[model samples]
Target: MKRYRFEDLPDIIGELLLKMNSIEKLLLENKVNNVVADDDLLTISEAAKLLKLSVATIYTKVCRNEIPANKQGKRLYFYRGELLNWIKSGRIKTITEIQLETETKFNSKNIYK
Candidate 1:
């Protein structure tokens, strides 16, 4: 195999860092809970975004059994109801849902209602 020049190392490192940063950002923004539980499941990355925390922090909380999580194979999922309950239970201090929006029970049809 051919060796890469020392000058190219910086570019490679920069690209890797950029990719990592993007992944971090994606993990944060994808935490939205607009989808129905029957529609799709939220990943650990999404939970981090929803909670406005880092992915590593999410894993740490999961490992400590502080947050509600479901593990399937190599993937972990967070249910909307369980996550909300976890926040209400005060297990997760950073993840907060706006309770003042409406005082109504959420079914499969309307959550924000």
Candidate 2:
């Protein structure tokens, strides 16, 4: 290790403090990410509330295999992320989006022809 002069001690300490602060921030961020990634499973009623549907409707969807779910014996569970994705999959395209898609398809076909 290189010898440090008295004048360099303060600078060295400040650098060390900055590194520690950055490491702490990184650790905290990782913990938050882990918590979000390991979200709790939702029961049928809770899933219904999240989806703004009735419990009966949730059960019907599960029976029809229209929604993603898990079953443990008689208990039903849903992943929040999967439920959110299921909602997203039913998204209706806006008029502008439909027009853009039509234009792209027409142009591509014309190019091939």
TM-scores of the candidates are 0.45, 0.67
- The CA lDDT of each predicted structure is 0.76, 0.92
Deviating ranges (above 4 Å) for candidate 1: 1-40, 91-113
Candidate 1, 1-113: lDDT as tens digits: 87889999999899999999999888766655344552456888888887788999999999998888899998899876677667778743332344423323344448564
Highest TM-score among the candidates is held by which one? 2
Residue-level lDDT tens digits of model 2 in 2-113 = 9999999999999999999999999999999867854769999999999999999999999999999999999999988888889999999999999999998999889567
Any residue pairs clashing in model 1, and if so which?
28-49
Angstrom error at residue 51, model 2: 1.0
